[model samples]
Target: MNSCATSFVFLRRSGYAGLLWVLLLSASANTLASPVSGTLSAVGSNTMAGLILRWGEALSQRHPDINLQFQASGSANAPSALITGTTRLGPMSRQMTDTERRAFTQRYGYPPLELKVARDALVVIVHRHNPLAELTRQQVDALFSTTRECGANAAINRWQELPATQDWPFGAIALHGRNSASGTYGLFQQRALCGGEFRPTLSQHPGASAVVAAVGESPGSIGYAGYHHLTPNVKAVSLINAEGQAIALSENSVQSGDYPLSRYLYLYVNAPPEQPLPTAEKALLDLIFSPEGQQIARSAGFVPLSETVRQQQAHW
Candidate 1:
């Protein structure tokens, strides 16, 4: 062959090989970038279930291949589900107890990743028609403390029985509280009831909405629930602090630590995610910490976290 002809043939072969390599790399990248399909299961925290469900609905629009399922029960059940391998994530309204955290670590060989999803204010609620708008810390304690039989005693039921109230509206103080499994119930018992048992007469409801509904439907009824659960039929009562100042619960007040009843909300994930989280599950959790997600939290009546907290939650 002529020298020029041989050189042209070699150059053409090299150009063709380079084009083939480019095509192969592009195909591999496309496969890696494609969406993954799988089911992600989470359980616990009925208080947060509604918000999470809404997020899931929105997430499905963007990630049709991923399947997400959630079960709302008591916060205590979540960690159990994780340890048993029944769920990848657990939603909890309160921080995990030391015992529970230890159990998860022992079973999984690593501690579960903890994420703070939002802030919640535990508010005292009364019937909208009730004239009493606030209660002193002492008065709140007195009402819930079994030491006084406030629940069963008619004498102490009236608003007038409360300190600093002589001419306030008078009526029986019907009490509504959550079931033992509820996180709000635990918090109320520790903070307001002073670890005292609730009165036998105190009505036990299953969830926050039920508690709020019970209080709202009954005249002179009082109860407590997360601020997000409060409705127009029920009014949130200001709590008198140790300083004797009445403080109303609000996102600003709760985030600032001025609201005495405010508490943290958490998401507990098995460390390293036993199985990879479906794209939809990861995206939904990401949205919960995103600016848009925080707005949804706020709209749901919970306190959104600060930017610092949001960033920390995003990593988990």
Candidate 2:
């Protein structure tokens, strides 16, 4: 072949290869870019507020295209916001009720997807100065329930009524707890009170922080809140289980089901199986399950799922 002809062939082949490489690089860049661009709104579950806020902040750093907004309403508000198409995500401290599911299905032609993201134990907290360190589930019931037990245990109105309450000069035992709007209150009622009603005298706070604060400030008082809310001003009191074991609240005990009040924390998504979840919503989910997300949960004083459960949940 002529030298000019050979040079032309080499240039043509090199040009085609370079074009192919450029096309591949472009595709890779597109893949790395944000898939969705829009605001993502989540509402409900004050128990999940701190963790979600942290996740949202991290998400902003990773995907500046997404604008994430959240509201820390009580868990009871999740189903309604989800039904009204007002929120892309809803965090709940409890599983959705059948009524809630039906309402959602009626509105959207499918039930909301429920994801278990974390676990919490409903702990009874008291002022650190209060010497009461433990109580049986039955005792908790008597203290909180209007239908008091046998005569001797009919009421736990006084701090002194509790056995061996040390050196506490007490008046009435002030009671505090989550308000009716809170999922924590519902769970506490079911798990601790055995579905009994809260005594009318029980002071109801709007959120866990308020309950913790109230209990922390009251000398002869106690309140129930998520285990994660434990702070220096207040102390978690151990609960006695059926076998007379004083189960301490911890990630290990809660995950092992040894803690009587341990329960799952959930995120209810408004996605249908036939349709893909919104990209921004899915990204937030990734952040929640990411290693950094789990660390954020730890910082919020909640328990991340155990390794086995976490792996299984990731596949979901």
Give lDDT for model 2. 0.82
- Report the alpha-carbon TM-score of model 1 versus the true structure: 0.80
Residue pairs with backbone atoms closer than 3 Å in model 1 (clashes): none
Over 4 Å off, model 2: 1-36, 149-153
All candidates: TM-score: 0.80, 0.82
Candidate 2 lDDT over residue span 1-316, tens digit each: 2764565567568877566556555655664676655798999887788888888888887776678888988788989999998886999888889999999999988778888888888898889988887888778888888864422257687877777584589878889998785677788888788788888988988667888998888788888988877789998889888899999877899987799889888999998877877778888888888778877888888888877877777666
lDDT of each: 0.77, 0.82
Q: Could you say which candidate leads in lDDT?
A: 2
Candidate 1 local lDDT, 1-316, one digit each (tens)? 2763565567568787556555555655654675655677789988888777766665665455556788997788998999999987898988899999899889978888888888888898888877677876656766766663223233256666765445556556788988876778888888776676777778898778899999999866788888888889998888877797888877678887678888888988775646675565667787788898888788777788988878877876
Candidate 2: residue 285 Cα off by (Å): 1.7
Q: How displaced is residue 271 in candidate 2, in Å? A: 1.8
